[model samples]
Target: MTDILGYRAKFGVLGPSTNTTVQPEMDEMRPAGVTNHYSRIIVDNANALSDETFLKGTALIDQGTVDAVRGVMTCAPDYLVMGMSAITFYGGAKGAEQWQSNIEEVAGVKSFIGSVSVVEAFKAIGGIKKVAFLSPYYPVANTEVRNFLSDYGFETVADHPFRAPTWTAIAEITHKQVREVVEQMNDDNVDAILQVGTNLCMARLAGRLEQELNKPVVAINTATYWHALRANGITDKVSGFGRLLEEL
Candidate 1:
């Protein structure tokens, strides 16, 4: 008999080895007929958190990603979803497009990347123009995110960076810290609140905050997953992740 679970689609998710949030969050959002398979890219030098070091870490992630994708391709997933956000947001829209094209060329599969997914999510939410966001990145990465948004015609009204010293440390950020940042970023000027960084554990929090703020609060993991599903024509309205998945 054919397996019923994951019979509809299988997704291959790639993330950093030090990340502890993406897998669990993605697992929570999975529907009955969908399955997610993950491959972790190595991050051997996860010391000192600075713009330079963060970029170096991203380079390391890039180095391992092709191999990781090749390994996961054995599963023959219907699509690829990048569970990491920093690399995707590094070079704005054109850069992200090139990155996705390269990955697809290597893996022989289409992908829903973090940077592109966020842009699409904002568009789906009625073309939200102004946004505030939080990230567990260094100042340089934050700047890249802002630039990325700007390229897509979205204005960033406010942003907060956790500046975690190591990739592992990113997962240690407390939910209390996230709430405070969300509160700081929330205002009438911004149309939405966005949370980048896959290891920050903001999926459920984004959902709850959306109800409180009466605006969209989106986590990267949620956006990427929702994008992958919808791109493949899976319109399953997943609950408890956020309005992006539940209502869009």
Candidate 2:
């Protein structure tokens, strides 16, 4: 039998333990009968981070993913939503495929991952060539995201990195902080701007900016969840987050 509230579809979402942003942002975008079940990949808050330490911390989160998957699989979710983005962008497009393939194999179901989902969103929206991005990650992780996007034939005209010192600090990034970065990255040559870190909480800002900037302001959480719903054949046309959900 299907879950009571999730009779339409139950998405098993996986993210780092220190993430407090993706869940709420995603819930606000959910359509009727679609429910989100989150399973945290346990990791101590990486407080005092540099490029080296940040890599180590993310490695810990990577190690915990399978256990998180098993925990969520108990609900028999119809699909998986990988709420983390850094790890998926680690080895470029081919590496993203392998990472997601492992998760899907473990969950025994189809899955939607953040990195690839954002690429799909760009494709659906069409004609997005040069791009810029902002991230809560250190330069190390940002390199991976750039590489992943480059693999998909998108060029990085400009990008910004917040290098949030702790996993929790990523969620602490303010709207003003993001807009400042957007202002810095905004260029006539860049057709779209993207925010990569899921915990950075940019979906709402992204949607609002698209109107103000007259360009696609793509947020990872919005892209991933929108990919999940659309790939599952649920065409709800969710609003508020961005055009990816509201129109495409």
Residue 180 of model 1 has an lDDT of 89
Clashing pairs in 2: none
For model 1, how does the per-residue alpha-carbon lDDT over 1-248 read when each residue is reduced to its tens digit? Answer: 34467788989999988888999999999888999999988777488557788888888888889999999999788789999888898788889999999999998889989999999999998859999999988888999999999998999999998998888888899999999888877888989999999999989988999999999998999999999998888899988988999989
lDDT of 2 by residue, 1-248 (tens): 77789988999999999999989999998999999999999999976468888888888989999999999999889999999989999999999999989988898999999999989999999999899999999899888988999999999999898989899999999999999999999989999999998899899999999999999999999999999999888999877877898899
lDDT of every model, 2 decimals = 0.90, 0.92
Quality of model 1 by C-alpha lDDT: 0.90
Q: In model 1, what is the error at residue 91, expressed in angstroms?
A: 1.6
Task: Evaluate residue 132 in candidate 1 and report its C-alpha lDDT on the 0 to 100 scale.
Answer: 94
TM-score for candidate 2, please give it.
Answer: 0.98
Model 2 lDDT, residue 58, Cα: 84
lDDT at residue 172 of model 1 (Cα atoms): 90
Q: After superposition, how far is residue 48 of candidate 2 from its true place, in Å?
A: 4.8
Model 1, residue pairs in steric clash: none
Candidate 1, residue 11: how far the Cα is off, in Å: 0.5
Query: Where does candidate 1 have its weakest 10-residue lDDT segment?
Result: 42-51
Best by lDDT: 2
